[model samples]
Target: MSHDVDVLALENQVCFALAVASRSVIALYRPVLDPLGLTHPQYLVMLALWQQEPRSVKDLGAALQLEPATLSPLLKRLEASGLVDRRRSAADERRLDVTLTDAGRNLRSTAESIPQTMIEQLGMPIPELQALQSALTAIIAAATRTSELTGEASDE
Candidate 1:
């Protein structure tokens, strides 16, 4: 049988494409982020914090689409690196808040070029990249809705 006609062909699978693309694109950031002393996940956390300061752990989790268990270690590592500070929220002692240290704030300047760098690396024009991003976002929303409808827990 031709591979094109095989329903189970790995190359025909959307998940396979997405998984490979995710890994490949993240790999591109590895070298750039190394000098900043950040792993991909930690970089995501910093992005959220850089957008807004003193966000609660819950808020950060929501923004990053990560569960607390997964996010905790990242926060701990960022704190250890002196890039972030985590403290109990004064308004609500039970809640934890995260804020960037000056170092984390300064890192944003260096990171500002990353988007353009990745675009050049991918050799994709701005409009095409934007369209791809839009499509992927729609896919994510649809997948999340399907999971919710089926009462299935989303890995996202």
Candidate 2:
């Protein structure tokens, strides 16, 4: 018994589900990240940098799938928080690079526990969490593919 309702239409809205899940997950991370003095975006940058030091800004932006303008302010905030440093390339004056500081490296010890804590909080088994991550990665890849295809058509 439906009164002008389209449940299937609502159920098909992947964007809505994605937005809800992303917001909920980020919210769960806020308190856990607070002590480390990092926001979700900042934490993401640190993850990238933790794997490699002294990445060029352009390369970092590309690796993170972020535009420079969006990443710049986040990097500035990380710099202000003493977690990251931005400097010009010694040989290439035109290029700016980012390096994690000692404080940033130190913070990793604290952050190391975050994933376990979040898993406990999420109450999901490790296998289930891994499956969820794999699913999300595929969804992201498909979304990116669709965007790239549309962008190429538009450009042509």
* Model 2 ranges with Cα > 4 A deviation: 1-8, 152-156
- Write model 2 residue lDDT over 54-95, tens digit each, in one string: 999999987888888889999999999999999999989999
CA displacement after TM-score superposition, residue 70 of candidate 2 (Å): 1.0
Going through the candidates in order, what is the number of backbone clashes in each?
0, 0
Tell me which residue pairs clash in candidate 1. Answer: none
- The TM-score, computed over Cα atoms with residue i paired to residue i, of candidate 1 is 0.94
Clashing pairs in 2: none
Best by TM-score: 1
Q: Which digits, one per residue and each the tens of the lDDT, describe model 1 over residues 1-156?
A: 675598788988999999999999999999989999999999999999989999999999999889999999999999999999999998999999999999989999999998898999999989999999999999989988999999986784
Most lDDT-accurate candidate:
1
Residue 74 miss distance in model 2 (angstroms): 0.5
Give the Cα error of residue 4 in candidate 2, in Å: 13
Worst 10 residues of 2 by lDDT: 147-156
lDDT of 2 at 65: 82
Candidate models: Cα lDDT each: 0.93, 0.89
Report the error of model 2 at residue 60, Å: 1.2
